[model samples]
Target chain A: SQCPQKWKRIFCTRCNSKRHSRDRCPSVWRVYLLKDDRPKKRKKLILPMHSIYCYNCGLKGHFGDDCDLRRSSRVPNEDGSAFSGDNLTNSLKKEYFQ
Target chain B: SKDEDANILNMDFPWTINRDHSKQKEIADWLTLEIRDFVSYISPNRKEIELRNQTIGKLRDAVQHHWPDANLHVFGSYATDLYLPGSDIDCVVNSKAGDKQSRNCLYSLASHLKKEGLAEDIEIIAKARVPIIKFVEPLSKIHVDVSFERTNGLEAAKLIRGWLDSTNGLRELVLIVKQFLQARRLNKVHTGGLGGFSIICLVYSFLHLHPRILANEINPIENLGVLLIDFFELYGKNFGYDHVALSVMNGKATYLPKSNWKELHPIKSTFQLAIQDPGDATNNISRGSFNIRDIKKAFAGAFDLLTNRCFELHRAKLKDRQGCSILGNVIKYRGKARDFRDE
Candidate 1:
């Protein structure tokens, strides 16, 4: 066979770059095509978000009483706006829904 | 000769000359002149209208001649103003020497007054009250209380003044609380109602609220002193001064008027209890009077509630059997119930 003069560089299928071979590439370039696939191992991440308690609903793991969905559900809605009833009825409904 | 002349010049003639017993006008004139001359050195503003001060000055001068290092201080109601028209004048005479020397100094001073004819009708009670000599001068019928303690031991005097000052707030609160209770007839606790305990309850409640209202809102030291004075004053006004004196003397629980008592819950107790006795009987003592125990209990209760601590109960005999403890069985029961519910 005749000797070849030059070889073509391999492109990364993940990052779409020609910088290095697949094994030498950064982990950030790795992508999982499906949820079942193992996620790439990288440095530990610390997010800025934090959880707060909702006063109105008397529940943990939420921010702001006004933003509590549970409180919205407790509000009266006689005009069929969303939810409405006496305290007993609402409590019963909450029990049923919960 | 000039020094002798100066000494003679300084010797006031009115005080030097003695008047006959039959010459009342002359004695009175001479005494008045002597007082005017003595007061001449003092500023007009500093001059007290009290003849007691004049007598004290004369005594002070006489004592100075014997014990030049002696220092005099004034104390008691006269220093503050728990004084009535007949309040006794209290003075303390302190010396660098010990008690024996101080006593000798006092004796010599008393004798000097006698030689000057100032002590003829004056009753010099050497062994009268502790910490004070009871001297009743015939010149003014004013009882002068004198003491011979070291000047260094002024802590008691300072504490008295401090306590009096601290009570001003307590006094104002007492007046307001008394008026409130009286107006609402919440005081009808004694006799056939809640009895003296109701006043205790009201005072405790007031004290409980005091720290909260006073914290950061007022000066604690100053306010506390004022409150205390006010509290004592109110207590004196409502309760007879005799009751307080007896309580202090005998260490007994004093009583207050039903009109000045404040039931914890007026509406709840109104139906279950009688407001007043039909016989219109009055308490021998007033509602505002308090003993050391009462003060301790009040402070302890107030502090406990403020700090969220359990209150300690001190028991006393009541009507034969040891009465209900001061921490009240009802209050304890309610507190336990609350705790149980919380748990």
Candidate 2:
């Protein structure tokens, strides 16, 4: 890591990428945060936001709220539009028809 | 002077930012100057605060006259140094706690205030989540909200104020972010928007997370500028609304075991925003604010504008500068919200 030159204080202990520090390396944890004021083994971690993985549906690209699989899973209405009234039951029936 | 200035920025602030714009302290310096100007213009001066203090002292005197044991304690922004120009002074009357009793206390106090001829337009938000007595003190020309419900607001404000005192650029960062919210009318929690205290907490959460600022390696002004962009970037794109709690005590995004934070706080899952109250973990500060989809939209817009210099320049032309408000139009620009009515 080239942090000692740029950050003047931070140093790289790992692969020493020229771009970012060791903690910020893609190989390391997403983010290294302390659980409290004191240094402890149980460090606080936050997931990197740039990943293809979604926290929502545990799928790729989209989050849980905007899950297309969940959306498309719901049964179409009498008029062919959709609502989430009986999504699971309706989706099962739709899947049976398919 | 050159050596001292170099010492201040630690030798490489200029050269370090040559290729990577993320480390651009120059831009941060510009943004810092703008924020300082805004803060100076908007924040109540020492004299004004003193006057408010004297007026509050009189109000306290009035409370003691009626109920000797009970005290009218000042909490919220006025208690701390965060109160903006003409913003309401939030005070809680430390007395009995109950919905009906709180209502009665407000009723009695309103009547007393009327008799004393100190205030007017004494309306009680009787059915509110935290029922409060709202009145306009003519002498100070400031609105005052008095509540009987005890929140950890005072203690939280104290903790934040302590942080503001300790950190060099925290006040600038917070005030800038606050002004941005206020301009956009997103800072008021009562109208289903973020509150002043919530904004303070949010800024604190960010400052806590960003290691460079904590280490005092970056100048606060520069840090504020850079963080201002990163603030929108993180909140806009990165931070998962459901999965993490903005824990001030922990100073990190406390990841939860459950998908939604209902187990941690039942009321939190009800709203789109998931900012955890530092004072009380159970209460979601953004409860009244809109659902998740709409919030993401606003943040996304702000993020785009801040990132694109061309867009900012264009928007800056449309700003309404009452004084130092560089973001008047930009921040306040209300983008379309996704209707969650069907959902």
Candidate 3:
């Protein structure tokens, strides 16, 4: 028997259907198969070009490190166990490895 | 009897059933020994590790010639100390020297390596999420993938190593679980299976939470065996598809406030198993090239083999009972890919 892992539903942005994505919707796939044509969405080509966002929180208007909720400036817990065991501070301890 | 060799071969390799039902303890003991031996067999030996390191160093040297300031690292299994006997070397090159726009750096690096006779099939897959240069050493048959992805390689490696050192027997337990997953053919991510990082995270999440729930007086190693069984059981039977998020950070199920994780983070939420990366909370290690249903089914299959009546016959006298067969069924058997397409 095949192991069943649920597929992360790739949806059609416009129709919000699992059957097809905006690029290859049934409406498009059916036509493209017969006519040998590209999807309307691709043909139009209105893509988001220069959109930059926080790599960490994936938010707008700031960098990942500068983002407010990035745990950017983490301090040891008040209990004082050396490192929070989080070890975010020493993220680039490349020298130690070298 | 005169033509014994041919007769034996013709008789479909004669086998004897010395299964003494009364000697269940002895059978369990034998299984345990087999498992212990399997662990050693699957592990990256000193020579293997050294060879891998040397291979990585050769690649780094090649890359450095082109870009003197480039920092090439051996990441993934080699860095994390969880490689099997013949695991591929995963390398990441962090360089300020190349066209950072696309994987242009990788393509350029690939061309440079090609000049040095770095073996055949040197391909640059620049369109991948982490665009990589994949090549195989023709002589040693060692495969290496070099990525120019902006990854915190050192931090990621250190975090895992630190976690391994945190608890006794943790490293061994992780290795054993990895072996189990590999044997079952469910360890591959590209073929809609769980990768090594995600598997390690899953086991960590299990061991972390088990201590709180199951209060046993057994030593850590024995405790690991029990936890391993539960690892299959919990993910197989109890885990909810929409409800719980698998995480190793807090050592517990990090519950999503609402039912759907995809709805909450639609942009990046891709996998049925959202294993939260401890180092970077935003990064879901389980995402990319995985089918949720398949992973769940693999767990369910393992659980069934472990708990079902017939399979349990051989397991009854074993210390962890499901120990021997759990690893066997997952590692040895190959199952068809169940319904996993999004639609």
Candidate 4:
């Protein structure tokens, strides 16, 4: 005497379904033969740059200690603008007292 | 045949049972005596310790005979344990002098042991990279995990133990962190159970709290041992100070009081700063890019304020009798402070 056939669950890849077995599926070979057609994306380029802030100075791109304009403290006589250190200190003190 | 079956019954496993009960009992008795004698011989003793040294010497000699210049040394549980039984002996043989010669020497020693009837149940594991023979005696039932490594010189070995000791505190910290996370059901990071990154995080957390925790005025090697002991005292249950309790008391948990939120914000910011990449301008902009250096400076400032200042403030609060018992209870529960009795 022969034994009864027992049912088993098998998964399907064509429709991403699990209702039927691969052997019972209609387009089993077709799904395996299909090729992916998505195109690859391009990569981005990077560039290097420095910030405006300088470590030497407490200001943008220059430091208070290395201020060249302040060091010279006087303009050439094209317009006759001359400012001495003592005059600047005297003006600052007068402003403070006021 | 019955007597033979009785004899077989006395052997360790793969035995046959027979009808001769008295013979079987005699075999059993004899087997027990043999096992007892072996156990006694294997127990920790001056003689056994000397024998271990002798075995190590013999191994070194065998290595040398095979390859004229091989350096051997012992390490691991055997060296650390005061009363160790059934602990495997670990040895490393350096074959940096000549690889091929060392390999040949290891093989010759194995062959020699076999010829001398000492290799009956001996496992001879050979390695090709550094070339060494790992000889394991089956009757002894003590494994010797041998490695043949390239010599990195004497200074490297001196640094090795110190480095190992220094991380001992970090290991305990990792365990406490793991326990805290587990208690709160937030232990997702260590699904594989306390990996290298997890350990690094724990160490970083402790170091983040006190950057000078690892600093010592003593020699580096001695400092590592001291740091490890300090770490153990901080987190070890035996020392009574539980890191989890301290972490909870310090308001690291989800149920923090409204008053603690200000103090906790900086800690959260430090974590946020750590995860942000400075190279990605888009990401930085999205996260509101503050200067990376400023974030680090802020973290250092906050770490000092949160750890040292907060600890001082909290300790001062303990002067009140109610708060004192809370601190005392925490210390007592963790086993940090011993109970006192009036005489």
TM-score of chain B of each: 0.36, 0.74, 0.74, 0.34
Candidate lDDT (C-alpha), each: 0.33, 0.52, 0.51, 0.32
Q: In candidate 2, which residue pairs clash?
A: A1-A16, A1-A17, A56-A64, B187-B194, B192-B288, B272-B292
Which consecutive 10 residues in model 2 chain B have the weakest lDDT in total?
B334-343
| Per-candidate total of colliding backbone pairs | 33, 6, 11, 5
Candidate 4 lDDT tens digits, A1-98: 35343345557664544654444332211111101223243222111111111111112222112223322111111111011111112323233224
lDDT of candidate 3 over B95-158, digit per residue (tens): 7754442666667777787778775688878886667778886656688887774676666777
C-alpha RMSD values across all candidates = 33.5, 15.8, 21.0, 30.4
DockQ of each: 0.01, 0.03, 0.01, 0.01
The C-alpha stretches of model 3 lying farther than 4 A from their native spots are A1-98, B1-33, B97-104, B183-185, B212-216, B250-271, B308-326, B333-343
Q: Estimate each model's TM-score.
A: 0.31, 0.62, 0.60, 0.29
On residues A1-98, what C-alpha lDDT tens digit does candidate 3 reach at each position? 36353465667775576654465332221110111134463232211212212222333333222334523112211211111111112322221122
- Model 4 residue B172 distance off true place after TM-score fit, in angstroms: 8.5
lDDT of 1 at B141: 64
Native contacts kept (model 4): 0.00
Better of 1 and 2 by lDDT: 2
Q: What fraction of the correct interface contacts does each predicted structure contain?
A: 0.00, 0.01, 0.00, 0.00
Report the C-alpha lDDT of model 1 over A1-98, residue by residue, as the tens digit: 35352355766664565654444332221111121223363222222112212222223232222232433222221211101111112223343234
* lDDT per residue as tens, model 2, B21-62: 322123334444454544554566566768898889888888
Q: Which regions of candidate 1 deviate over 4 angstroms?
A: A1-98, B1-53, B99-106, B117-132, B138-140, B151-153, B160-343
